[model samples]
Target chain A: MSAIERQFYHFAFDPASRVVRMALGEKKLDVTEIAVKYWAPTDELLKLNPSGLLPVLVENYEDGQTVVVCENRAILEHLEELPLSPRLWPVPMQERAEARRLVGWFERKFDYEVNALLLYEKMEKRLMGHGAPDINNLRAGRESLRDHLSYFESLLETRNWLAGRSMSYADFVCAAHLSVIDYFDEMNWQKYPHLKTWYMVIKSRPCFRPLLNDILPGVTAAAHYKELDF
Target chain B: MSAIERQFYHFAFDPASRVVRMALGEKKLDVTEIAVKYWAPTDELLKLNPSGLLPVLVENYEDGQTVVVCENRAILEHLEELPLSPRLWPVPMQERAEARRLVGWFERKFDYEVNALLLYEKMEKRLMGHGAPDINNLRAGRESLRDHLSYFESLLETRNWLAGRSMSYADFVCAAHLSVIDYFDEMNWQKYPHLKTWYMVIKSRPCFRPLLNDILPGVTAAAHYKELDF
Candidate 1:
C-alpha cells in the first residue's frame, strides 16, 4: 500500500488559495505547503501552471502518476471528486446551485468589485515593489466592501449559512475573501452584526486555524485576527 | 406531466453565454432565449442575478419549483448535474482537470488580459456609446491575443481536442471566446494552421450555427465570419 502525496503551491492572503487551504483542512488531506510570492512566481510554478496563478495542487499517487490542478475553480472541482466526508457542495440540487453561485460571486464579482482595488492597493502593490496604497482606491474599495457586507448580512439574517442550512464552499469563499480583507483592518465589523457573528463562527473552525497564523513578511494581520471570539 | 420550461437570459456576443448555448444545444434541451443587452441589463435580469452578468439560467420544473443559476461557472455546473447524454467534463481525472483549468483560464486570466481590453475596445465600447476604440489599448490587447493564440495553437498541434483525447467544455470555452473575437475580424487564421482547422471543425458543429448568425447592431462581422470553411 502506498500514500497519495500532495503539494500545494500558494500565497498567504491570496483569497483563492485560502479557500483551497480550508478545503484541504476540512477534507483532512495532508499536504506539504509551498509558499510562493505571487508577484514573482517561480519557474516551477509557471511550469505547473502557465498562468503562474495561485494556488496549484499537484497530487502524486504511489503509482508514479501526478495530477496538477490549477486555480480555485479547477482545484475545488478536483477536490470535490474525491470520496471524502463533509462534502464542500451540498447534496440537494438547489442547495448545491446556491453554494456554487456564491462561490462564483466571490471568484468573479467580489474579487473585482472589492479585492482588485482593496487588496491590490494594500497588499499587492507593496509585494510588487510598487509603493504604498492609493488613498482614493482604498476609499472606493472600502465603500464597495460595506455595500457587499450589507448584502451578506441580509442573506445571513434569513439563512443559517450563506447558501442555506448547510455549511458549504460558499461559506469558505466568503470567509476566505473577508479574512484577507480583515487582515488589512479594513472591515467595520460592527456595522453588520450578522456577518460579524458568522465570521466569528467560521474563523473558529479547526480548518481555519492554520490561516490565522499565516504571516506575510513585514505585513501585520489585524489585532483581533487570531482571537476565537472578538 | 408538464414539460420543463427553461429561460436563458444572455447577450449574443458574450463568450460565457455562448458556451452555455452550446451546452444546451449538445444536450438537446429545449430553451427559450431572451436576449438582453449585457451592458444595460433589465430589471428581471437584475432580479435573477444581482451582478447583472450575462447568461443567467432560470429553470421552471414541472413540479412548480424554480431554480436560478447565475453566470458561467454556476450555470455550467447546474447544467452538468442533469441526466444528459453528452458529458462536458471528461471521465478521466487528469483530463477533467485539464478541461476545468482551461475553462477557468477563459473565466479569469483570459477575460482580464484579452477581453477586458480587446472586446471592451472593439465591441463593448460601441455598445455602451463610449466612443471610438483606443489604438494603444488595441495594440496591447492584440499583442496579448497573439501570445495566447500561440499557446493554444501549440496545445492543439498535439491533442485532438484542447483538453486531450475527449471533446469537453474546454473546446466550447475556447470556441466561444475565439468565435467572438473572430467576428470582429481580429483572428489571423492563416498563421495558426492547427488552430484554424480546429476552429473550422468546431464552428461547423450544429450547435454553433446560431452563434455564427449573431449580429450586433452597427457592428459588422468579418467577411468570412459565417462561412463553414475559410
Candidate 2:
C-alpha cells in the first residue's frame, strides 16, 4: 500500500466539522485534526480552501500528490469513494438517494433554520467578540428545533435508522448538530423518545468518541455531553 | 421500453428549482412542470414534499410505482443515475468529486451569500405580500455577487468547464443562479469576459431553452436573457 497522510481542517464546535470528523473515524482514516479559526482565517488556510470554509480534508499519497476536499457534503461523498470497510452510504440505489436527501435536509435546511440561529448566536458570535446572542434569534431557533426533532422522531418511529435499515451518513449529520445543541442544553429529549433512542445508538459508536471529547475554551459542555445515556 | 411519467413541482424564481429543471432536461426526462406556491403551499404540495420546498420531482413508472425526490442536490444525483444520453457527472472518480465539490460551492456558499439576498429581496418578498425590498440586503447581495462572479471567471480561465474539460452539473448550477440574477437585470456581464463567455456556452445548450422561456408575472427578463449573443 502507498504511504497515506491525511489532515482535517475544522472548528471544534461547528456541526459540519464534527460530521466530517466522525466520517473520517468511521472510515478508519488516521487523520491529523487542525482547528481553523474561520472568522479569522490564516493565509495558508485560505490557500488550502479558497471558500474559507470549515471541514477541509487534505490527503497526501506516496506519489507526492495532494488533494484537498472542501464542503462537508463533498467530503462525505469523497470518503464513500474510498475503499473503506463498513460503508457510510447504503448499497441500494433508492436507499442511497433517500440517504442523500436526508443528509441534504440536515446540512442545508436544518442548518439554515436551526443551527445558523442557535450556533451563530450562542457560540460563533461570542467567539468572534461580537455582543451576546440575540434572544429573539435563539427563540426562533428553538421553535424550529422542536419541529425538526418531531420530524426526525416520526421518521425513527418507522425505520431502524434515519434513511433506512442501515446506519448511514444521515444519522451522523443529525447527531453532529444535535451534539452542538446539546452542548447548549437546548434539547428536550423526553418529548421525543424515539429520536432520543436513535441518538443513543449513534452515540454508542466508536466514531463518536472524538466528538464527545472536544472542548472549546471558555465554553464548557453540558453535564451529560459525554455520557452514553442521559 | 416502459412508459415513464414525471412531474416537477417548482417555483419560477427559485435557483435550486432551476438547477433541477436543467438537470432533468439534460438527462432528457420528459417532465410536467408545476409552479408551486412555496410560501403558501397547498395540502397536496405539502403531502408530496413534507419540507414544503420548491423543486420536488415525482417519477411514475408504467407499473403504478412512484418515487419522489426532494433537494436539488439529490435530484441532480438521482437524474445522473438514469439511462440518459448525455452524462451530467464526469466519468473518472476524482473528476466526479471535483464536480460535486463545485456543485456544493454554488448551491450552498453562493446561495447563502448571494442568491438568498438578491432573489429573496427582489422577488420572493414582493410575491409573498411583503412590502418593498430592503436596500441594505440588496447592497450586500450585489457586493457578494461581484466576488462570486470573479471566482467563476478565475476558474473559467483555466478549464473549459467549471469542474473540468467537459460540461457537467456544476455549469448548470452556476448558470441557473446567474439566469435568475440576470432576470432582475442585476449582472454586469461585461466586466467578467471569461465568465460571460462561459455563460454563453452553457446558455446555448438545448436544456437551457425551457428556462429561457420561464416568465414570472410582473417581472420581465433582461434584453439579452434569451439571446445567443449579447
Candidate with the greatest DockQ versus the true structure: 1
What's the TM-score of every candidate structure?
Answer: 0.97, 0.93
Judged by DockQ cut-offs, is candidate 1 incorrect, acceptable, medium or high? medium
lDDT of each: 0.90, 0.85
lDDT of 1 at B80: 84
For candidate 2, give the lDDT of residue B90.
Answer: 80
Q: What share of the true interface contacts does candidate 1 keep?
A: 0.62
Residue-level lDDT of model 1, residues B84-171, one tens digit each, is 8789999978889889989998987789999999999999999998999999999999999999999999999999999999889999
Task: Put down candidate 2 lDDT per residue, B42-134, tens digits, no spaces.
Answer: 787888767777778888877776777787887887777677769987875556767888888887689889877888899988789888999
Best by the TM-score measure: 1
Q: Write the per-residue lDDT of candidate 2 for residues A56-165, one digit (tens) a residue.
A: 88888777767778878878877876777779888765577778888888876898899889888999888999999999999999999999999999999999999888
What are the per-residue Cα lDDT tens digits for candidate 1 across A8-58? 999978999999999999999999999988889999999999988899999
lDDT of 1: 0.90
